[model samples]
Target: MSRITFEDLEALDDDDFTEDNSEPMDEEEQDRLFSHWQSVASTHQVSIPAEMAGPIQQMTRQSNAREPVPFATLSRHEKLDEVVYEERMYPAGKWACVTKGEELYEQSISMAFMKLMRYICKENSAGRYLGMTVPVLNEIQISKDGKSFVRDILTAYYLPAEFQQDPPEPLDPDIVIVQREPVRVVTRVFFGTTTEETISRQISSLWELLESTEDFLRDTYIVAVYENPGIPCRRNEIWFIRRDQ
Candidate 1:
C-alpha cells in the first residue's frame, strides 16, 4: 500500500471520508492507515502550536495510560547549586525498538512510535494484544556538526512485566525485541511538545551545566516523554548516559 503523506492527511475532508453511508474501515485497515500516516509524518518536519498538538497528544495518551515501566532512583543532586538534574538507574529489561534515520528528532519519534504501537496492539507473531507502557524512550545520535542535525533515532517501548519473559516477535521486520542491560544516566526534566529547536536548547543547557563536573557521552542522549501530549504541564526529560557507568 502507498504511504499517506502529511499533505494527504491535511487534504482529507472529514465529511467526504466519513460519509454517513460509507462503511467503517476494519481494524486491519485502520491500523494500516495509521502506520502509513506515521511513516509519512516521520519525514515531514514542521512546528506545531500547542493547540494543534492535541491529536498527537491524544494518540500518545491512549497508548501510555497503562502502567509505567519501572526504574530505580539511584541518586539526586543539584547542578551549580541549583536543582537541575538527577541520577537514576534503570534495570535490565526488554523493549520493542524501531530505528529510523531521519533529519529531525520529532519526525523520527512520530514514525517510530506508530510502528512500535502496532506491534504491542497485536501485530506480532503471537497475535496477542500487549498493552502500552509509559514514557516512550528515544535514543538520538547527534550529528558531528555539533548538535545542528540529528543522524538517527531509536525509539523504544518497554515491554510490560507479563510479556517480558517471552515477548512476542514483531511482524514488522524493522521492529525488534531486545534485552537491555542496566545503566545509570543523568537526566533533566522539561515540559511541553518537543521540537528540534527546543530539544537542542535543552541538550545544550544540560551539557553546559554538567560539563565541568560530570563525564557523559556527548554524541547521543535519550529523550523521554511521560505524559499525554495533549495535556497541560506534560512531563518530558533528556537523559545523558554517564561515561563511568
Candidate 2:
C-alpha cells in the first residue's frame, strides 16, 4: 500500500473539489446531480431516505455574496506511529446539517451524511452549490454493541466562510443550518484507509491518550474524516471536545 503523508493531507484542503460557486445549479441539473449521487450511494450500499430523493426546499436565497470565515489549527504531541495527539480550539460557525435517531438514539450516521451531501450538492431550496471543505465532522457514539463499534452519528458540513452569517436554508425538513458555539478540542490524527476496525483502534487510542493528560475535561468525541473514497492516501481525525470546568 502507498503511504499518505500528513503534508499531502494538508494539501488536500487547498484543492478545489466543487463546481463553480458563482452560479447555483438550475433545477434540472440539480435533479441530475442528486440522481447521480443516489446511484453512487446504491453502488456503495448506502440508502437515501425517500424525502431526499427529490429537489430540496430553499427557505432562503443565495445572493452569492461571501466573506471568508477564519480557519485555524492547533498544537500536537509527538507522533506515535500512525496516531498524533493535538489540542486545539475551534470558532463555531454555521453548518449544513442532518440529524436523525436523536429520539430513538439509533440513527445511522451514514444517513445523516447522505442528507447533508444532498444539501451541499444543490438539492436544497435555493439550489446553492457550496464547495466541499475539509474535515467532514461526525458526532460519534459507541454502538449498542459497545466499544467494538461506533454508531448514532450526526454528520455535518461546514458552510463555506461566505455563508457564515446566514447560510442558505436546507430544503429537506430534517436538514438545517445552525450556528455552533466555539469549542476547545483534543484530536488524534489517524493516517490510513478508514475501516471499522482501524477506526475502532484509533478511538481506543484516543481515549488512552486522553486519559494520560492532566487537567483536561472531556465527555465525548467525534470523528473528522478528510478524504474522498477514491483518494489513495487519507487523513482521518478523532476529535475530543473539551468541557467547561
Candidate 3:
C-alpha cells in the first residue's frame, strides 16, 4: 500500500562497484556489501535487480543464532508453561512481520515465514546486519464466519545489546521498530506441524483454563514457533496475554 519514492531509492545507495574499478567484488564480497540492503527493500515488495539473487541466498545462510529474550516458567503443563516473562524494556528495533494472510493455517504461516526471512536477508537503514533469533511469533484470531485467520505473523530479531541506546531504522516499511513494554502471559507448548483443527482445539483449551482461574484475564493470544520448518519435531507455543490487574 506504500510507494517507493525517488527519495527512498536515493536513500538506498546504489551498488556502484564499476565506478572506480578497484577490483570488482566477487560473489562473497557482493553478498557482504549490497545483499542486505537489497533484501530489506524487497521486504517492502520493492523491485530489485536480478543480479542480487545469488547474494540474497548467501544472506539467508548468514542468518544463524542471536541472543534471545529471557523469561522464567512460573508453572509447567507437560512441555508447556504459564510464564512470568521477565520484565524488561524491549529496545526499539525493526521487526519483520506481515499483517495479512489467508484463512488456512499452513498457507498463511508459509507466506508470513517468507516475508520475515526476506526482512532478515535485507539490511536496515544503518547498513548494519542483524543476527536471527528464535521463536517467531504469529498472532492469530478467529473470524465471525467461524474460521481461523492469522491477524499478523511477527518475526522479531533482537537488536544487539549495544543498540539499546539507538537502533537503526528499517529500510523497509514493513519492518518497523517500536518499543514493547513488559507483560505477563500464559503459554501452552506443543510440537509437530500446526493445523487448523489443532489451533481451534488449543484456543478453546487455553481459554477454558484461564476462565477457571481467578486472577488471569486474556486480552489476546499469539502463536510462537521456535524451530525452523522441515525439522521433524519443532517447538510451538500459544501465548495468551494476561490483562493487568
Candidate 4:
C-alpha cells in the first residue's frame, strides 16, 4: 500500500474523511488521538509540521465563553434577502487597546490580542483581574495599494460594565485605555473563521449593500470576532461608523 503522508491527509476534502459524518470527539477521545499521533511521529523519527499541528491543537482547545460587551440595537433592516444589518448604539465606555504593525491582519491581531489579554488577566498597574470580553474589535487601515493592511492595526477589548468607570491601567506601554465616545454604527454579521480574504469579501458585500453611500465613513472599517480561534462557526461582523453621528 502507498504511504499516506501528512500532505495527503491535508489534501483530503471534508467528504473524503469518515470522521466528518461521525459525532464530534469528546475531550478524552481528542486527547487519545493527539497522543496517538505524537507517538506515531516519534516512532517514525518525524515531527509534525505547523500546518498539521494547528488543526490538531485547535481540536483540543477550549472556546472562549466570555460575555459580549453590551450594546443597544437601535434598529434593524434587511439589505438583501439573505443579509440583515443593524444600526447599533454603543454607549461611551472604556476599552483596552493595543496597536500592532504587521502586513498580515491575522498576525497583527494575534500579537495585539496577547497584549490585551495580559492586561485583562492582571498585567495592569492595579494588578486586578479585569476578566474577558467577547467580539474583539480590530480597526484596520488598508495600505495605499489597497491589497494589504497598513502598519497601524488597532485591536481593542471592551472593558466589562463593572470596570467601565475605573478600568485598571495597563502596565504595558503598548496597551492604552481608550475612552470611546457614544457613537452609532451600521454593522453586518457573518459566520465562520475570519481571515484577510474573508474579511475583504464581507466588507465588499456590505459596501455593495450600502450602495457606497455617504452615510458611513469609508476610510476604515471595524472587524469584530466574537469567538476564540478554537471555536467553529464563529460569529464575525463588519462595522461602518455612521457619518451622521
Any runs in candidate 4 off by more than 4 Å, and if so which? 1-65, 79-83, 144-147
Q: For each candidate, what is the lDDT?
A: 0.69, 0.58, 0.53, 0.68
lDDT of 3 by residue, 1-245 (tens): 23444344445433332122334457886654454444334434444456545334444344344456555555554425454222222233434455545545555565555555555555565564555566676766655565555454444444555564576666556666656555466777676556667766777777665535544533345777875442334578777765562
Score residue 34 of candidate 1 by CA lDDT.
48
Which pairs of residues collide in model 2? 57-125, 57-171, 58-125, 58-126, 67-162
Model 4 weakest lDDT span, ten residues long: 13-22
Q: Give all TM-scores, in the order shown.
A: 0.71, 0.63, 0.59, 0.71
Ranking by lDDT: 1, 4, 2, 3
Deviation of model 1 at 64, angstroms: 7.0
lDDT of 1 at 30: 50
Whole-structure CA lDDT of model 4: 0.68
Number of clashing pairs, model 4? 0
Please give, for residues 1-245, the per-residue lDDT of candidate 1 as tens digits. 34445455445443322222224456674554345344434334533323323233234324434768788887777756876888888889999999987666676776677677667766788886676677789887777877465657888999989889999999999998899988788889997657678888889888777755457887878889874332334479999988766
Q: Which residue pairs collide in model 3, if any?
A: 36-123, 40-122
Clashing pairs in 1: none
RMSD of each: 8.2, 8.0, 11.6, 8.2
For model 2, the stretches where C-alpha displacement exceeds 4 angstroms are 1-44, 47-71, 79-83, 101-107, 143-151, 192-196, 211-219, 230-233
Writing each residue's lDDT as its tens digit, candidate 2 over 162-182 gives: 667868888779887778888
lDDT of 4 by residue, 143-231 (tens): 77777667678999998878888888888899989998887888999986456788889888888877558888767789988754433
